[model samples]
Target: MASDLSPASRRRMQLALLLTPVSLFFAVFFLGPLAIMIATSFLAPGLYGGVEWVFYPHNYGRILGFADPAFEDFDPVYISIFLRSLKIAAFTVIATLLVCYPAAFCIARLSERSKNFCLFLITLPFFASLIVRLFIWVLILRQTGIVNEMLLATGVIDRPLELIYTDGAIVLGMVYIFIPFMFMPVYASVEKLDWTLVRASLDLGAGPIRTFLRIILPLTSPGIAGGAIIVFIPALGNFVVPAVLGGAKVMMLGNLIEQQFLSARNWPFGSALAMMVMSVMLVMLFVYVIATGRRGADVTN
Candidate 1:
């Protein structure tokens, strides 16, 4: 093919050849696993807790409450768990955005050296294991932890607050872990912001709040949307945070899926639940892309 092509065409062929390995890698590692999971979802669970060769729609039915008559009453439990997961994920996204925006703005306004240093510091935690980071949180938020002792010393409370093993702790853990996702996109946008336009808005007698609302917010919306997507997707499917910090009292979709697979040995039901979570994430990603595309077009216009 290279021998038959012009120089430009040869170069293009070479580039395509180079990308083949990466494409094959993704197909094997990512697409292959997803395909297997989806296929397993459509099959029946065997007596020995594996998938049988038999095909059945029973798993989907179980998830949607079309299974047995007795299972009809349990539909509300699944719905409630899904709704609760959504609420927690939404709260995590909001909290991450709120905290990260100001930090990103400040970093974006800094000198290049300072910006890099700060970014390095913010990402330093990633060098450690995620489980270790979570354990650190447990040490901090536990009833007899340093945080409680510090509060007591400062006379902030008469008793140690129930800081750990609660929904509030789960939210706090999620926000802490996911803040970098929100920060990076917002920082990218803010770093590219035109301060001159802001000055011009001020010179044209627009108030600071109005300038921010009309100019800055609109221009930075794509970044916000990207961050929200990054934060919300993982939070919706989080298991470790809810299990460790929330004391297993608040069961998110991820935990339920784990239970189905591990404890109940119901692989088909777990696959169905996993597919449902994936479906929701795909829908969210689609909406986010459309919104960001429209915002980008508006900015250009």
Candidate 2:
């Protein structure tokens, strides 16, 4: 009976079968949750802790500064947290790039075996539990931690340095966790780089700095941008790193969202805060798409 059909019909049936599982998985896991969240974002918060079915745009108004006068007053802290999260995420990208870019070039120039070993070492941190790794940093940064103990023995100062629970500490933790994320992309770009162009630039009387800026930088920019996007997006919404390293003194957008949901019990407001994060991610994706499209067009020309 099946053999009676044309090849095109059979092919279409196969394609549909292949797509069915993926489509169902995405619809069930991704789209389902996203639809629920979007719906909840517009709904009012219940008196206790859950959501109310009624539409309430005030959830967003609370973030944008137009909350219902009777329920709650507007606060700028949400905006501040959003901005601070952006700043920290930007710093994390820069730091991760700085740490990975040079190392990528170094690895790219190494023997295949050595390069593989180094890559393995770079990824070895992932083998450990993230919480355990973060706790190691906490132990090293705390007042009675190793640094302080060593400094005290050397008599560097009477008091331990304030290292943990700061913005810098948060950035440091993010950089540590995101190094592998940034490195692999940059390494791929560097590994594929045309060294002959660099040599040609030098032979054409361009200085080292000029040759690098003109030849090497543009060629590897795609990887850098890729790494930056991956690093920045997750870093923006990272709560665990900040919670561990930043403490209560330093709160980011992720922490704010966590508090609204878990502590404050404002489900609508929490959903609103999550929507803000989703909005930022969408904007970043849009920018990346535009930049990628332009780069492709330039190459074609």
Candidate 3:
């Protein structure tokens, strides 16, 4: 049948066959749930849990302030959660970058076998359950956990200090999980780095700091930006880490959204919060694309 058809016709058929399953998968799995969530965002919450068919714009209005007087007043706590989540995510990105950037450089300079071994070590966490990995930190950070126990044994402190359920703990956990995500991109950039330019800058009477700023940093920036974006996006919406590390004392947007859906039984409100998170992600992606395009143009020029 393919032999009888024109080349263009056969190509079109092949493309159709290749795209059909992907299209169906996205439609059924991705777009399907997205459409349902968007619709649910606009619907009213029922007296008994679940959604009411009536269209209600207050779902969003609740977040932005100006919620319907009959239901509830707009609370600024949601806004605070949004800001806190953003801060934590940003910190996670910065911390992950700091840890991965220099490590990438070191790994890039290693022998092939050493590089592979280092990569295996970096990716070892992924083999285990995420919850299990997080619990290890919980044990290490808790009052009677490893750190405090070691300190107490050495008489470093009179009592165990609070290590877990704080913003720092959350950021630490995020950095641990996201190390691989940040490392791979940075390593790719570092591996491809034009080291000749670095040597030239150093030879031209430039200081190490100046050479890094003018040559090395700019060369490796794409990987840094990419790593930051990937790390930030998931860190922003991460609930599990915050739940296990932050506890009730520290609430992030992810935890807030979870509470609305599970504890409060307000799906519409939860969907609204989710939409807000998605909006922030889209905005960041747009900014990243624009920045990347401009950088590309500058490089070409």
Candidate 4:
């Protein structure tokens, strides 16, 4: 005996019902996997190579504790690997920012049709397989590769420089792979910006440097944050670049965790290390949000 609802009300109900699928999808795909990973971190390693019900906090402790014959000391080797990963990630972020910022600015300034075309070009590499891209770098940066040959021909170097199988090569490979991530966010932000604000800054007696520092950079800060987080987090966890370009010599936390689980047969320990990385990423993302808020407020003010 209820009265029928209006069309708008029915539409609202339909939309609400539609959102249930999205919510369930997230729960199944994202939250469920994350829960499994956390549960695995607490479980003890099984004899046959799986999770055991024996819960031990020592797995986490052993990661931070000193390496000792008696299992009493912290492992410096793991600490060193973590530090090296941080260093490489930092370098990759810096290099990506330097290369992408100008390119993004240029793309942002282009006409809409041109902008889309340029973006497509940037994304073309993604269509190719990642392994293929890495292999291309191997060919380009090999000892007797085109780069070394060109340098030798130009007399820039007397001998072929060790371009491959080094930390530098790994960083270069990472930067190449990640540059698009850095570019896209910045370009989006830049494209949305009000050009009038920049003109106003210049109209006020602000020089180019002052305008950029005070106006443009602050307005585009969100993009920088997004791009940096995107680049840094993956670079921190990457195993492929170091393995292929670095010849397994420059081991990162990802490499160590991989070795622990696959080669060393220490699932519990690897899970602990992975949990630490995830925890650090969570903390960093929280801090980034706070910093973004402050910067946004400054820009609006």
Global CA lDDT computed for model 1: 0.86
Worst 10 residues of 1 by lDDT: 65-74
Q: Could you tell me the TM-score of candidate 1?
A: 0.86
The whole-model lDDT of each prediction reads 0.86, 0.92, 0.92, 0.85
Q: How close is every model to the real structure, measured as TM-score?
A: 0.86, 0.92, 0.92, 0.83
lDDT of 2 by residue, 104-146 (tens): 9999999999999999999888677888888989999988999
For model 4, how does the per-residue alpha-carbon lDDT over 98-133 read when each residue is reduced to its tens digit? 998988888888898998999999988867788888
Better of 1 and 4 by TM-score: 1
Ranking the candidates on TM-score from highest down gives 3, 2, 1, 4
Model 3 poorest 10 in a row by lDDT: 71-80
Runs in model 4 lying further than 4 Å from the true structure: 1-33, 46-52, 67-72, 153-156, 293-301
Q: Write the per-residue lDDT of candidate 3 for residues 1-301, one digit (tens) a residue.
A: 5499999999999999999999999999999999999999999999888999999999888886668879677677777788889999999999999999998999999999999999999988867788988999999999999999999999999889999999999999999989999999999999999999999999999999999999999999988989989999999989999999998899988888899888999999999999998998899899889998999999899
Query: Per-prediction count of colliding residue pairs?
Result: 0, 0, 0, 7
**Ranked candidates (lDDT, high to low):** 3, 2, 1, 4
List the candidate 2 regions with Cα displacement exceeding 4 Å.
1-22, 69-72
